[model samples]
Target: SQTIHQWPATLVQPVGSPLSLECTVEGTSNPNLYWYRQAAGRGLQLLFYSVGIGQISSEVPQNLSASRPQDRQFILSSKKLLLSDSGFYLCAWSGSGNTIYFGEGSWLTVV
Candidate 1:
């Protein structure tokens, strides 16, 4: 059984602070990992994705960046936070099919 883990479950940060959100996939090898963000009531937006370690693709340009330092570990980071960066961030993975599973998600509030 493959599963994705993301944390922290919630975060409160001031504007201009740094941010780091971690996600990892268990029980799978070389799976496609993705970082998606959903605003208060908006649809999920693809921020970044990785097909392999050290290989990342950005879907949109923003204040955040993603890295896959290890095979199954994906990280999202921001050097400086912004009020517009507040949202529900979800980590997801897909393996061998169209089905993608998501984590419990992290709620970020920038004050």
Candidate 2:
């Protein structure tokens, strides 16, 4: 019964504005959490991941950062937004298995 939730489901922000996307996992403890971005017609890119509280790994150098303030809570943020930052953001969680569950996803449009 584990689930991942992310929000706001859709966003439209101006360039140079700050951004914050939050994700949380339920019905599981110490699950691996991840943030992924998929540009239009592109494959999913691993952004950040967390194995435990206060532990975060960045898969690529980007304009965003992630934080694991709690065991099941992960936050993705950027001090300023970029036009290239527009994309679909997904929050995922995985238990001790290879199976991963994804959220409904968030659509970000930087104008």
**TM-scores of all predicted structures:** 0.97, 0.97
lDDT of 1 by residue, 1-111 (tens): 888899999999999999999999999999999999999778999999999999999999999999999999999999999999999999999998978999999999999
Give the alpha carbon lDDT tens digit for every residue of 33-79 in model 2. Answer: 99999997889999998989999999999999999999999999999
lDDT of prediction 2: 0.94
In Å, residue 57's CA in model 2 sits off its true spot by: 0.5
Local distance difference test scores for all models? 0.96, 0.94
Lowest-scoring 10 consecutive residues by lDDT in candidate 2?
92-101
Measured by TM-score, how close is model 2 to the native structure?
0.97
**CA shift of 7, model 1, Å:** 0.5
